[model samples]
Target: MRIRVGKHGNSLGFVIPASVVRERGLEVGQEYELQLTSSGGLELLPVNQVIWKPDLSIDELLAGLPQEKLVYEDVPEYVPMGKELDW
Candidate 1:
């Protein structure tokens, strides 16, 4: 896809196509880090982008953990001392 640079106020800017925006999950007013590649090509990367999988369940998220490590062998019983709130 080709985009032409035009004047925006006192600066030159280009419009990002809606198709590319939707594909990349880009949001309005989101900041990006502009970089110049070794080959001299321009690259834009999302700033502080988080890689998350919200669809994963708790069990699925912990599937990689060893079974033995999941269980606590022994835990001291809680005893309420003076001035401490007891439930």
Candidate 2:
């Protein structure tokens, strides 16, 4: 689909289609990093930064630092599962 660059408050920008935004989970006023590919196509990426760790390696990183342990005692009883009943 082709979209024309239109003027908004003296600034020019293209209107992103609603289907494209919904499919990509994009929102209005959200930041995006735009870059030109080697083949001359534009790449639009979400500027929302997220930090994610795969596993306990992050815990190990924290363990290397000085930290205080919690003083709470463990609760002992396990809650048993109830028998299945038809609705």
Candidate 3:
């Protein structure tokens, strides 16, 4: 886990080993949150969800009224649609 600080263009970074990367099934272009511990240790955490939260007014809600029904398909009694199997 000892990585040397290397120059990366205008920034500096540590080279993560391929064995560690493959074992964790990590990919390129993925972002990880780094935490600095009081004991001088680095911890990497993966970000899963990024949700957009916006403030909406009553006028915005009224304008977003849909003309169509939310569910267009008929529900069958035998099939379990919750499992997400597409017919």
**Best candidate per lDDT, number?**
1
TM-score of each: 0.52, 0.48, 0.47
Point out where model 1 deviates above 4 Å: 49-87
How much RMSD separates candidate 1 from the native structure? 10.5
| Residue 80 displacement in candidate 1 (angstroms) | 56
Screening candidate 3 with a backbone cut-off below 3 angstroms (N, C-alpha, C), the clashing residue pairs are none
Model 3, C-alpha of 28: deviation from truth (Å): 1.2
Of 1 and 3, the candidate ahead on TM-score is 1
User: Which scores better on lDDT, 1 or 3?
Assistant: 1
The sequence of per-residue lDDT tens digits that candidate 1 reaches over residues 19-87 is 999999988899887777799988778988634447989989888776664323333575556765442
Q: Please give the ranking of all candidate structures by TM-score, highest first, separated by commas.
A: 1, 2, 3
Best by TM-score: 1
lDDT per model vs. reference:
0.77, 0.72, 0.72
